[model samples]
Target: MATKSDEDRASSYEPSSAGSDESHIPDVQNDCCNPLEETKYIVSESMLMELFNVCRRCQRLATPTVHQRVGTMVKIAAECEFCGFTWLWCSQPHVGSIPAGNIGLSASILFTGALPSKFLRVLRCIGVATLTQRTFSNHQASLLFPVVARVWDRQQRDYVTRAEDRGKPLVIGGDGRADSPGHCAKFGSYSTIDLEEGTVIDIQLVQVMISFQRTILCCTTMVL
Candidate 1:
């Protein structure tokens, strides 16, 4: 079982202002609310390569040509060794699971002009703590959605500019607004990417409304 410390208890994990208006939605609580400690589970690069060699030898011998079979069997016998209880397998999927680099959460907080440390701290706490839930409450979901939207928007702009530079017809889809405006009184947008030109050309925003009376006030722009 995980242990909680004084720091954990003292921490005030505030949800991001991006979704503050959605506060009428229920709060997301975790059974283990503390920040998780890092665990060392990955094998070193050199060791992983060595394990690959063993797998290759086993696979090579498992082939059934007579002349190569003897050589293959000998090689397999020599390399069929296990270093520890952990089994070695192809590293592609495993490597994909490991984060290549940090998201620079601390740097973002330091550079943001108006946001205070307390607020950033709260966001960081909530972001890291709720990572395992897979799904989030409406409020929690909205908190992180804008960040993703901004990134997507930037990438789309870059791709479109590149395509225009290449003198391509920037085909685009018409925007659609939902009939019912949600608590945010905003719409959801969708776009299709022109993979050949690496551009997002078709774009649409559809409005949606939530009838729930508990809906919170929607602000034009989020203030940190």
Candidate 2:
């Protein structure tokens, strides 16, 4: 026969939520929030470029073969020479996932007074709508955007080198603008350009909270 104490001990061992109240739980508010990522389908250009040409497991060459094409957009399939592991790859500025290169390109275009909608519109006109602009925009905001300054600097250096090779002095120009129609806007920008080449050499931004003079002093700050 069980004693009263035994019954109490058994009840204590059973599940109880903070004096039998679920509300006391921390970290988990309602256990009803949906996950932000549904399915991970993103692949970068560098990754794809390397994926098909090398065996991930055996470290051997994976001879790439063309599998499909939608006009210039291609899907390159490969099988490893040693392990026989197979995978698919795509070209630069991915039609499936937005490439890191495109992140910088899109940013440069925006810096040059072009709207992001123009990129989307061009993609649509080309019949390459496998990827959405929103997805690329999100990627630019999250991942590739942080390193775009380095990319821009590299681009400028390369362009300068090319101009030097041409043995001609660069005809440079500059401009600045508010992001919106009115002066009371959240953001503004300043840019220097290679007028002869029609390429932006460098750009900078100024937040509304900061003074315009300070914008000149610390104006190398860029945005995406």
Candidate 3:
């Protein structure tokens, strides 16, 4: 059910000159990039095509250019045949070089410690479009990991500094967990915690040896 306001909002897709030298066309709807007022809408393809098929300026059918789609983000450029005007519309906003959707999805997967391959498989199985594993890995290395690491280091420093500021000996506890029983385990994790403050201080992942063979396996295993 499309309302008059929604129909009117379609006109906001302003076109730039096809001959313009602008490498990027900014989305007017989300130009500010304000996090607090962020909003997301799941729009149907049919509805989107309905709005894009006609050139808002000339009120005539426009020829759409080759759609540039990156995972969940899509950019549509349409040129009005009559007026020779061109406009680019993006499905999601951009944060620097990466699309907001890509960043959000990648960050969510990393923060939650979810397995990217399995989680993305779930999305793909259910018809949800998302970034590929390679893209996720790239984002993790180039963007997500650095930020997360910096924040983690800062937090760890703060926790330790606060404990030291107390001018007393701190009680700490340490524990280790293995992925499997006996020598079959391929990985192990050790964690240190402040017993008095009930806060985790550090976590380290260690590779386990199996049957006198050095097998380097990278994975998180849950004993459930």
Candidate number of the best TM-score: 3
Q: What does candidate 3 score on TM?
A: 0.67
Which structure is stronger by TM-score: 1 or 2?
2
lDDT (Cα, tens digit) per residue for candidate 1, span 1-224: 11246325323334443432211322323244221232324343344344334334344312111111110011112233433222322211111111111112222333463344464456446432211122233322432344445555556556545765777454432233334544454655544445455444545444444422111121101100
lDDT of model 1 at position 173: 28
Go through the candidates in order and give the C-alpha RMSD of each one to the true structure.
20.4, 21.3, 13.3
lDDT of 3 by residue, 177-210 (tens): 6666555466676666778888777776765435
The clash count for each model shown is 6, 0, 0
Give the per-residue lDDT of model 2 (tens digit) for 1-224: 24557546543332222222111212211134322212224454456566568787787988877665432235678899888898865543331232323434445554676666776678567655233455445545544444454456567667757876878655666667766665667677766666778887666676644544565444232211
C-alpha-based local distance difference test score of model 2: 0.52
lDDT, each prediction = 0.32, 0.52, 0.65
* Clash list (residue pairs), candidate 3: none
TM-score of each: 0.25, 0.32, 0.67
Tell me, by lDDT, which candidate is best: 3
The superposed Cα distance between candidate 1 and the true structure at residue 99, in angstroms, equals 16
- In angstroms, how far off is 149's CA in candidate 3? 1.7
